[model samples]
Target: MTLNKDHIGGLIFLTIAVVYGYFAHDIRMFPGDQFEPFNAQTLPIALAWAGGLISLVMLATAGRSAEPKPTLVNLDFMLVGKLMVLVWLFAQALSWIGFLAATILFLLVGYWLLGERRIRTLLLASIPFAVGFWLLLAKVLDIYLAPGKLWQLVLGA
Candidate 1:
């Protein structure tokens, strides 16, 4: 059996799932949350198990694939590095510019990095999606999101 992309991906996914499951047990809960049916670790552990199962299925079905293994010489390492930087910048921007603003910037920069140059497309794609997701997390889920240092300084909110 050759080690194709599917094999490598399945192996990586399985390894990460196992590691995540191992760490999920360490998630802390509230004083009385331990006795509940679902707690801090429940969803994580469930996702780990589901990922592990899916990875196993992928591994099993990967053996019969007809495609030959391709070399990685054509891989876009520079794009990957840029994306990594973008994610790091987004994390840093979250505290400085707030979730909605940071998310819009992240999507805009990501789309630009992927060779999209149209400003209208960038704004249309990023703004509405970021605002929708922000509303979902903030309004629908009732999660507490910081207004960011810049917003707080400017608006005093």
Candidate 2:
């Protein structure tokens, strides 16, 4: 009846791993003979096992630590709430705007939300990170990322 934070957290983690592991296992990663020696399934299986191990560690540590019982305060709800909302916004924006522009907007907004006040820091960091990621994905990886209409016009595309 009385579930401690450790028990609850471990339960949540275990549940996630079980659900994810099921889906990961269900995917037919590669054909039989043609499969690479280390196929896609290996990574998912490793992740599932690692997640389980981490959950076990969390359970053990929570039980042994003398720290006071966990409460809502221990979870840092405000920061978590902001992070979740930011992720949601980023996902929605990613489709309409290209990856680079959306990501740059995301970084600026996230920095502002996190109470970063320096304009120089925001501009300097956002520009390079956004441009570098785009260059790496587009040029180095031989991948094409969607450039929003605005960017196309700006870059003469």
Largest lDDT belongs to which candidate?
1
The digit string of per-residue lDDT tens for model 1 on 1-157 reads: 6798789889999999999999999888889997899889889999999999999999998888765686879899999999999999999999999999999999999999999999999999999999999999999999999989998899988
What is candidate 2's lDDT per residue for 1-157, written digit by digit as tens? 3467787788799888878888878777545823666776778877988998898888777766555556675677888799889999888777667898899999998898888989999999898999998899999998977766666667878
Top TM-score hit? 1
Clash count for candidate 1 is 0
Q: Give the alpha-carbon lDDT of every model.
A: 0.94, 0.81
TM-score of model 2 (CA atoms) = 0.53
Model 1, residue 63: C-alpha shift (Å): 24
**What's the lDDT for residue 116 in model 1?**
100
For each of the candidates, the C-alpha root-mean-square deviation to the true structure, in angstroms, is: 7.9, 7.2
TM per candidate? 0.54, 0.53
Worst 10 residues of 2 by lDDT: 28-37
